[model samples]
Target chain A: MDATVTLKDVAARAGVSVGTASRVLSGHSATSPAARERVRAAATELGYRVNARAQALRSARSHAVGLLVSDVRNPFFADIAHGAEQTALASSYVTLLANANEDTAQQDTYLDVFLTQRVDGIIIAPQGEGRGNLRALEEARVPLVFVDRVVDGFDVPSVTADNAQGVELAVAHLAEQGHTRIGYIGGPPSVSTGRARLSAFLEAVARHHLDDDPALITAGDFRRASGGTAAAKLLAHHRPPTALLAADSLMAVGALAEVRQRGLRIGEDLALVAFDDIEWFGELDPPLTVVAHDARALGATAMRLLLDVIDGGTAESVVLPMRLIPRRSSAARPHTAASHPSV
Target chain B: MDATVTLKDVAARAGVSVGTASRVLSGHSATSPAARERVRAAATELGYRVNARAQALRSARSHAVGLLVSDVRNPFFADIAHGAEQTALASSYVTLLANANEDTAQQDTYLDVFLTQRVDGIIIAPQGEGRGNLRALEEARVPLVFVDRVVDGFDVPSVTADNAQGVELAVAHLAEQGHTRIGYIGGPPSVSTGRARLSAFLEAVARHHLDDDPALITAGDFRRASGGTAAAKLLAHHRPPTALLAADSLMAVGALAEVRQRGLRIGEDLALVAFDDIEWFGELDPPLTVVAHDARALGATAMRLLLDVIDGGTAESVVLPMRLIPRRSSAARPHTAASHPSV
Candidate 1:
């Protein structure tokens, strides 16, 4: 009836040596069948629950993985968590999800906690450059996988969307609408996704022969308020852009609010496109145009790669493709009839 | 440099007893200052990392709590998780979040995993009656708090919204707009919120002296697809209700899509109201009217309560109030100008 019934108690009840009891309980293949049967029966009779931590120390497996996301409130990350958790459950492994809240310090704190917990593996949508606890985790040689984003010096297997292709699709679609002056709201440069997408956007603009004004590029922290602030600055320019693109969905919503407050229609006055696709984006009056990728698939793939690493198998990094889903947000420009086509 | 440096090794290196080293490392106040200093030096010299599970067994404190939500993808629950994690982090604790995905079997599995992990406490938006792992958790007397929803027989401290008041407010507003027949799309009765809201809707209809046709009430699993199905069923009736109220935000979105497909303008042909407000709800061409509650506050309060229980305090249950935010979706009916006032 005591909660702290130990292996010694089970061993005594089974009339076996402590070493034999432990090996049987830890599922060691070398244990005799008779010893395993007696130890199991004794454990059941005495209601001896195995101390997971102690057992993990002996067996080097906990059957639990840690998933660290940049922000839990972001729908894209939420969808990813759902996919990863479901996949983990199917494999009989529990996922312990932690939110970094887009803060590098918070991400480090969680990485330390995951290490302390001794999870079988970890799948992370990393925040910034791998440093601090991330370095410690790598030094410890824990099974690790990157989801959606990766750190600078880490040679970890990752599941990420093709940022270059996604950016190109958005830019090309906007260019086809005859908008030569395109403004871009990008994420922070500290994050991999932010840097990749920004560089891709610049490359796409040059390839499409659009205006390359320095003032056209603004940055946000991948949050809604930053989108609003960035949008305000761009629209206040001497000659504002005819079209705007955001790096993420939250920022896009913020930009939409800003455009509305300034009495500008989304499709009519300024064309808008967002990087990530979300369910509610389609519900907006003039639904948003988005560079779409499967967030759930990304999460699921990361989980599978982590499991493979845990099983001592090497996994190749996967880069999923992206496509443009043009809605009313980037409809044809009214005056440029020759270059634009109705969508 | 070994990852498995034990307390015995630290004690041996420090020329002290293992008991003294363990007492010092576990922060037992009874340890002498000299012993504490010696153990600290030896631990640092040997690069000793305490196994969290082993320490949890000895100290019976893990500084980690499990939070089980019905669905991680739901913005409402996601907000709750954000609030809870922030509060936990402020207290120098970690939150291990698990998604039940609205399935009782999955909920039980996560609960079992939480117990095995030896979390300091748990906060759950529980599903179904108190059974399986829920009962086992109660028997174990692990510090527990319910958030948003509660089980039938558990006396756990909880933070929940006033579902009755929320439902009554929506129904009264619809009746005031001269909607004699209002359709109700509610959640499954297995959940506490579902039962509370359904009964409240029935009571409000009686109080307002409006039509209470049995055919007007329908239920869903609190999912988007179920909402669409329920909406279709209600709308197909020979005498379809003029106004529709969905129990949750996802269901509201489903109903919105259904209404649009039927070519019925929300504010003109049919009035729609949804429970649970989301950020994007306001961005719709005709913004949704919602029964609003602070989801983040609900999560924060639950974490605070669970922490109290963990500290062996008798925490009181909290019931958060809800209010109606009337928007374009529930604006005055065009033909019933005399009974309705413009919103």
Candidate 2:
């Protein structure tokens, strides 16, 4: 039997027109019972399976969605991809996952590929403000959903974490621990999470009456190397912070390396807190303090939103709440017990 | 301008046939220079973009490859995916990654989907021994390459780590450290890595004149929770081993948790070693000793082999070498120094 048997072959064998055969094979109610029966028999006899590309060309529905994450190696994004892919699979939709590698140019390249692929929809953890293929996707009127981060000027439904609340929780805990000078390592300002979290950190710092020194703030590309660079800059400041907070898990790992290289001990000499909570964070020697949010839920929710949009239904944006989990990394300051009686 | 402009529309505007327009647009050398120029002008004027699905149908090539990993959330597989996707992109091909979630059924489902999507080739970290869609894919003559694991009786080219060498290295290291009774936490026997590593462990132990107690070996399903379960079983043995070795990173993590829960200090009371070296392994309190293999290189190599097969070239199987990195976790046995006087 020929493996590449087409619909035309089935139609010919069924003694029916290609249109009637297609309708019957696609389970369209418009087909007569007799025509459907003949087409079914012919298809079964010929061992003909529907060609997904041809079907997609005809119906304009590929039954596939593109999921573009900032970085695939990042555990947070990996969890998200797992969640989204599983959710999409449950709906009989395949997810084509792409990694932007935290580069805006790479993100744009993937967005263009996704557009060309003509996926039913797209869910993206965007890298930059609205530019390049991001604008093209919007102009093409593709059903789009943002996960974790969003582009500016795009009115797209998104699933994001509560950056302000997470920052507040971490800052408040540090304040309670009598850490008056805390360094901040954040993501690049081009990204929504970076902007939102940095602003939230500033707000939290002001609310806690802590040192609001501009020199205490630094930014990375939300990657490990950048985190180490940011940490180095903050630690070298003339009035260095006693504590440090990284906006993401990779950066936190990088910051930890820098702190260790400087002969400073986490949870003892300097306090540290990270935004995302990875599985192994708790297994670290002194463990780690983290602002926790569900990365899997973020991906799942973004997929759900994309599915809804694909079905021609509008979806509302979702902002998930965050909480702080204090571990040994942010243990209370021993020296502060004398100066700050509250400690 | 209409977004769905067809080649026929461009052909009509160019005063040429649809076939001429298609050949010109697809960069076929058979097209006349005049027709090509006219079709290009018409296509540009009408803002006509070739639909990827339609092109795939016409060419029988999707210019996409499906990569099905055993587990997406596993850092090892995630790194592999990143490498494969990046390599595929460099060749102007997109990689559609799917997570098998460590289940055979899920692997079959994704394989079938990849077939339906008419991908040019596929790379998989297979779960079971030559069953389900694996057979179907083989019969269909799809360009296939195996990464990390290969099924029995399959002639498929694979890029796999030298499991025997890795296991031998770990076993010898433990033996040299004065651990005669080493408990092994291995992957399920059904998997290639699991079977190969276990057999290698047995052979190494017998060669070194160490204890070959069957009770010292336990198997997990190459997952975290399974590792913990296996560890629990090993630790509960009446004559428990002084040191433990996990076959994979996730299992190692699980074993670590189990040891911690029992208040057994790693490196001091119980030595530990893992097969794969994750990035943060060195950052652990006592750090982790691991048999390290380049997961990214494995993925990249698999993809290159697949592309070779797709281009009608026979490719050779690649066996990547592994090395052991000794850390505090697998430090020398303290009491053995006095008793054996070999330190």
Candidate 3:
């Protein structure tokens, strides 16, 4: 669907007058609740794209895009920001990055800042429910594209990694390596990627006929320290998993330290794999095996999507593919074939 | 010094009227060159701190600070940004981060954005000469602080690593290993840290009476790929050095790959020490010895200093100390005493 769909099309589909449809789209309180709902549903069904340039023609163009990241400390997000900013700069636009620091309130604050700064468009690694400033952005008709995660029921385009595929790849690789009981350290369920990957892990393990013990699973807040904490808990179990899968790179780093502290060698005593790939990962003692996601490309693609929206073009959401890169971290031989009870 | 020094005091010291002093300080084009010179010199001498809060009281507070970093992809700056943002958030201020990508033109673009955004203040890890936006920031009386790198002749508060001390520790440790022919991969001389570290390296080599050949020193852009290029040039020499020192962690990571590609064993074939200490360094095969600088503390300190200035509090610039962390990377056995040109 292109930007050819207009308010008249939405009005016709909603069975409302063009004036009422325009009023509802403009967020006018005079509209009835039923009419508002119909107009919104009709707009979504018709794939009616907002003409951001037309909405913004009243003000001079700032040529600035606000990029709100979940966390600046996360190297994955940092790489994404680099890619997005470089792409924006190439198009003569500058990206002003704000770190939500993985907090909803902080995200709201930056959203307000972006609005007041009059940024031409915004690209966010969104957090929390689609309320408050996020809703405000849609109401204000600001051009936006979600980068990593997306909120439910939001009519926003996004460029995100295939989290389910990544989790399945990591799990199948460990199962093939004779690890029947694999410890899974996942992210908080509140985040979309977190929930998707965790669900994928459970499904993949069942497909491989591996242990479904509750003790094998743990969740972290997608940060480094949480990974360490989760690893510690898993290792202290009576029957620890022979292999470990961390949902992200930061958590994996934390897990590596915890494993080393317990005098267990990675790739040997405990096979390990993480979700994201960073350049320095290969420098690790036994290079880290990872489910590789192109974070830079994700950022670049998101910017392109946002620009298309800003230029009155409609674009589809992108789900980038992922692949597994095996290194020494998960390449060590198991003691015997008996470790794989399912096979 | 304190913001107590007023226009009257400056004018009196410079033998000019209060109106003339105000014009010069306000960057009024009507001011004479001599008057601007006298006013600036007098202000510097009196340590006339800008009262950004007072100047900004006329405009509604944005409560947002701009933090311009050299490179977001560099983990060092990433850590610094995290620390600064967390601290800023604690103060009920949000940080807007812009990546210069190690380019001066990019730096200018972001500076303009910050200015137009009406940020309460700015903290920059600066590059290029002390001109353009760097000068505009000073003349505009915007509260500013330098982190990691400082531009010369800018009387801005800064939080920077002790380059001399860091270089001394890394060089002395390597020298004690009886490896006199050490290769140094430094940063571009245009950068402050780069120049300081290179000068320190040259002096230390002279002090230790080691190989002072110009070929022993090479320059990179403080990025990963440049480090690889520099390492390739160094290793392809008529006789490669037994020890190598990369000025920054990114460059060091690149050197690691290059050394490995050349089939050189890091700990056994050549001793290596990097300047910045990152968490993953210890996870490298044989581990890495480093000159440790707390990047988080550097960032946190710079933010605190910037906040103090915004609050009209006088504070001294900080020169943080550095330490040496010895690991297997630099614990290799020397082939013979003949490796020491002086001894």
Candidate 4:
């Protein structure tokens, strides 16, 4: 047992041939169920991990990478994924993607899966504080890069947008349009984007000398339904802001619906601006004004960084610039529309 | 050479220990590159697969499933993925997703990857003819299920929408609204949904005695850019149709942009209907009327079928129904909006 326990040792202990033990370890279907159970038990008792790690020792390359997106349903993230995937394809590596659903637990599960899958590298739009699998990846020296968002303590190479500048542009535009109060719908404080954008909103509002109402800010989990809930909360305040700025596009959609349901109109009764300029934003009734960041570029850059890391090259973190696209949703308007038609 | 070749034979041929041979076969990265190359060459020369098939014999369950979506960026497929992932998670299984990007070659690549990963089952929105990995999946007796789209000539269990009926509803609605010709933006004919929907449109037009102008039909590769191309082609016709029916949400978005670019207002200058009623589709300028299919249900159903197949149960193919949701996009109106407002 002390002399490097192998499949032979496990097979001997299980009273099965080495071939049977090997079949059981390889997960092939031709072996008897009884043999499977016995060999597995024997392997477990002998602490035999060679089955999973055997081939990993021979070649450092898996020709596969792990991509963890915060939410696949978010058009911004989806675009980023497309860009990353295309770039990876050009490099002859396939990406295995996992949706974190913006939950730390799901993120941990997928990172664990990626390690077990023995991928060569990883790119992630990280969620929550660095812990669990995120920390494990760093410790294991897995090639890693962050995209869109970064964890607080992780010094991983990343491709993130300048949230402060983007927020300032949106607020300055609204302030020029004579809006003294703006409701802010933000993502949870757990994520880096959420903290950065929210902080920027606060700074921008103060610089513009807008109303410092405590009720003006609400947070959502960055999912569609939570966005709706946050929007509703912001609107229910006794003294609601004359304009709304959602930190992400999904929340902006919810805010739009909430405003329309109240028989108010965007670009008229209230001004609106959102982060993340999705393509369909232009097709909305009022053409949502946005703090536009190239999501696809962020994804593509992250993949490049990961590849560099995999090749034993140094990877530098990148912060992409963001801009505001002015549209009808933030245009100054006369009091015209109150009742809205169904979209 | 006459007897069965084993990992031992390959190890002997490669001049490595049995443990080293096993490590190389298991894809472990800890072994030396030279050892890996030798072992691989030896295994190939001896036709040694016993090591690869060994663990597969244990339970034949990797607790992983493959989901090959047509396009992950499409909101419909994203919703489906969410549903399938949630369902799989509830059953303590993980799903490995791949994007075909509406390409047959990409589909083949992912299907082959799934086999090597030893996934317990696979759910695919298949593209092109039933060859390559599709045939390989059947021959290998891997649990397989199709969703959203299906390939011809394969008797695989599937969860597909009634595409013909969905198309029929769209055409009939347009006919009842007094449209003589309805422009159709459809997917490529290589996919089942594309063929079935197009056929249904043609049959419906004939039944209604509407003009059979061939210019009314145009096909896209099921991406946003192609949708724009098809719509532009349709609108450029000498006698353009009053109504438009796009095959999917992304295409509909492209068509909407094209229509607006031509200074046409939806529900006024041109009636538009589409398939796949995505969540935000209702939030478009004129809420799109759609032959709505439950995309999430399709995904969840496909996962259930795959699970059934994995459990050795006979999986019956499921065909879900589609319905029409009337919105302003398809409202009958005069051709009034020649100069559309920038939205």
Candidate 5:
């Protein structure tokens, strides 16, 4: 068996006290530069590996971050996580990802586990409607960052796409194409993004001087199935809107299917605009029009902020801009006078 | 500062030798029940942790596993990672995921980093062509489990979906739908899945008494753009195919766009089948026919296998079954001769 080199041996070889060696080797910055260099040299000569667990035990800092997300299966959340991972890795920190699966109980258990593991910080994308677990994370005083959605009065660093602006982009684009009666499909009101997007739709319509009908507004759980269900409700009304705005790409795809089921054509019959420009959206027939968030960039930025906080900076919040890409789906509203042959 | 309790303290309180206390704490079998009970009670009272890192150091075993993947942003890989995370968390092991971006240099660097980190084992889905860096992993005698792809002639465990059977299912389904000339659009042959899928497609077509037309087969790189490129090649041919088989969902989506560009409708003018059921596939105008592999289940199973190996079990391979889901896309192949009326 190879002989294990101890800090004491490094200190003796460097001709420094054990405390000085410890401070220098642990990067505590208490030792003089000359002494630190000698200590480092001696440690290198001895091939000394500071027992990470032992040091963690003494310092009570694991240098690990815990990232909890609603679902790992979702590409949107996954992109953010990748960004976090890249940032964390660059900062010599490890991130542990916990999947909440939108279950409060499971989220709570994972939070407890992470706390026990003594991570330096946490980044959470809360699942549905649970504040208890988030409150616990906040109170832990172990720097936290929230992504995609914001919690009211949480006072933590957060990164989110401009939900209202994104909605406005979609609505204004559709209105420009002469879509008077426009429909909105958003996620559940429980989530911040969902609520903001839905409200924004109404505000944007009013701003654009278009008729805001309560019957045209529908809400689902940000799922394609829910979008299909909501589209059914809106279409069954007295007269369906000429254009539809879905808050997510998945929901947009669902709306597209629902429209086709009614023997309607996208862009031509009913203009469509969805948010979150999912990967396949670009390749779709009459590729979807979208108010898009740079998913990967959003993730990477959140991670960088978390890393900054971990590197001993003050907490900050960042709201990223959204870009509206007009695809074939939102080319022109069919019934609009601009699209009609000489009236 | 909290006073640190030593193992000697626990040993004294339990009225047992330090060796006996160590054995009980390490979960090794002890001679007497009373001694075990005393050690357990004493440990509970003293708040002792088994100190996994210390045990690993003394035993020269790191109890850490590394999961290397091509890309984490893809939902397919993310599913596998989620599974691995669940398995690692349950087994009290740490799993590190490294994304290589399908770059050999990046893969090599990550592998080196894993080695320097002294992980107990590794699970890699190599970029498939690089045996150069793998020699180190193999020489370290680290139990390796390859997931998603296999490196030829490497005596390591691998877990992958049955790609051939999956392709056969798609071909048989298309043939039964009365599609005579089927075009196969596959990913690059460098990948194991892509190669196996293309071969299986040909085999299945031959078994059904169909001619193997070179013009009907085009290779892509498992991406949306590649799918479009492959589709264009097949479509531009003098004798175009009535049905198309895409090796992956992204490619299939590309194919969908290409067909639509030519004023062809899915389930009518062109029959389609795709591998990997991406989220939007079901919500497409006509739900896609897919050869589906549950990525999350694959990741979870691979992690389980790694845990077993780390826990003193021998290395083994796990082959997950693939399923073909028939949807609207493969409902019928339209007679283009009638649709065009001039062909």
Candidate 6:
């Protein structure tokens, strides 16, 4: 029972040249129906699996896509990866993922490897502020798309959430609840998403006619520990905020722990809203109010855009929509009712 | 500016033959100190960024390692990938990770891609059923090490958690808590880790002189939804188990949600313990008692073993240690007077 089947056997059974069989099996549309059907039947009969490695070397297309993320442990990225996987699977392509851990050098290394492997395209959630090697990838005519984050001046294809609008929704939600003194716990200001969301928060505060409290804003690196640190700093302010807006879910989790640690009731004592509705958010004790970006949608859209780019479509960018999921965390502000004249 | 630099330029600047420069740059110790010094100086002066891809193609060894995970979204796999990357970095070997998504076909696709990319070695967590096209990969003489799970008959180098021991720890801990009848919810019996853990759970019950209650055992596909289903069945039993042991973290999360949804108090009404100490486990309300397998350690050890295999070591398996992390979830049992004191 040697069971090792090759494309040659498939070609022989199909009565077509090996090249035609290869094309049919690779899902290339150029193959005629008669030839494709023959190849398909032959493949089934022989139990012949396409030799993807040989095909990659011959065609210089790996039939694999590269997915680069800032952090793999974050459920946000995980959701994106899952979405990308589903899309890739549908198209008969596999995804190779790399977690750059926000390291610029690692990103470069992954890009080089992807190039060497000749992947069809790359979808990356870049660690903001590095475009040197990314530009090199573009120069090499590699199909690359940015996901979740965008580069400063690169005219590359991308699919990202409406971070500013999402932040605006969170801010408006808080304002409607009478949260005047609101705190902003954002990711590192170096990242584009963080900067955009923070700016939106300030603009929303002004638009809602609320006083800006500079002391209540603290920055984090989008990790739980950073969230805890930011929350602690904001809470210790001379005039602490009545509500908090976390830039991401991990930060929100950290903030929740911080609030609990201090014996503060989530909805009663302090209101909170966050971004990126990661899985298990709904399962939390007091479900969090969040400006939710569909991570899977972002990944799927980025993959589609990259595939188009790989097929010679004009490069473009996409901004995905966001939704505000209201939960128990944000409620009517307790302090405002006593002071307002409408009461 | 045409920024492409080649080995010839460095050799010319160093006033040495191309062979001498190539050997020196490649870190071949056979080269004399004078030649190496000249090559180093020339490289530094020329700012030569070696085209590692070209070098790899010529020498047939990429200073790269391929890592294949079951799913990138699984925090357990992500941690393992992180560990592998950290270790690969220390050795100056870049790590390329692929998310197989537990699909045999997809896993086969990645194995082919990895082979074509010519990674020096690979660390794979197989999809856990069937021999797959892995036999072809083995025939290619690629250096590979299995992580987390391995095929029953394949004598591949591997590094995995002590699943049996982990289950024993959980069962023993619960048993000591005065819980008699305990339910075991596990993944598909086809998976090595799942079957091993489930068998160990039953064995531990027998060893501890506890009743072998057939109604207390159920299996799922190792999904949260399946865990919820399994939990429902167990809780609905006439004499519900005093404690529950889940095969993995996601299942535990599912069981926890189900228990809470049913208005049963965890750590009191129904004690719960699970495998895989995922990120949110500690942050979970009432926390989670778990048989903690260091996924990071598993990846690092697997990669280390892969490097060894690449360097001519025999294919052997290493079982990493597992421990129990006590949290509030399984602190006490409600039915303290039950005769099955061994939970």
For DockQ, the strongest prediction is: 3
Q: Is the docking of candidate 4 incorrect, acceptable, medium or high quality?
A: medium
Q: Write the per-residue lDDT of candidate 2 for residues B213-292, one digit (tens) a residue.
A: 99999999988899889888987877778889999999999899888888777888788999998888988877999999
| Residue A247 error, candidate 4, Å | 0.6
lDDT of 5 at B331: 76
Better of 2 and 5 by DockQ: 2
Q: Any runs in candidate 1 off by more than 4 Å, and if so which?
A: A1-58, A332-343, B1-58, B332-343
Docking class of predicted structure 6: acceptable
Q: Over 4 Å off in model 2, which ranges?
A: A1-60, A332-343, B1-60, B332-343
Quantify all predictions' global Cα lDDT against the true fold: 0.87, 0.86, 0.87, 0.83, 0.76, 0.80
Q: Model 4: what is its DockQ?
A: 0.54
Candidate 1: deviation at residue A48, Å? Answer: 32
* lDDT for each residue of candidate 4 in B58-159, tens digit (9 for 90 to 100): 245567898989998999999999889888887667888888888888888778877777788899999888888899888888889999988888879999
Model 6: lDDT equals: 0.80
What's the residue-level lDDT of A300 in candidate 3? Answer: 96
List where candidate 3 sits over 4 angstroms from the true fold. Answer: A1-58, A336-343, B1-59, B336-343
- Model 3, C-alpha of A107: deviation from truth (Å): 1.7
DockQ of each: 0.55, 0.50, 0.60, 0.54, 0.23, 0.43
User: On TM-score, who's better, 1 or 6?
Assistant: 1
TM-score of every model? Answer: 0.83, 0.82, 0.83, 0.82, 0.69, 0.82
Q: Which candidate do you rate higher for lDDT, 4 or 6? A: 4
lDDT of each residue in B69-136, candidate 5, tens digit only: 76766667777877887777665555666676566766776687567556667888876665767877
Error of 4 at B225 (Å): 1.8
Tell how far residue A309 is off in model 6, in angstroms.
1.2
Model 6 chain A: worst 10 consecutive residues (lDDT sum): A334-343
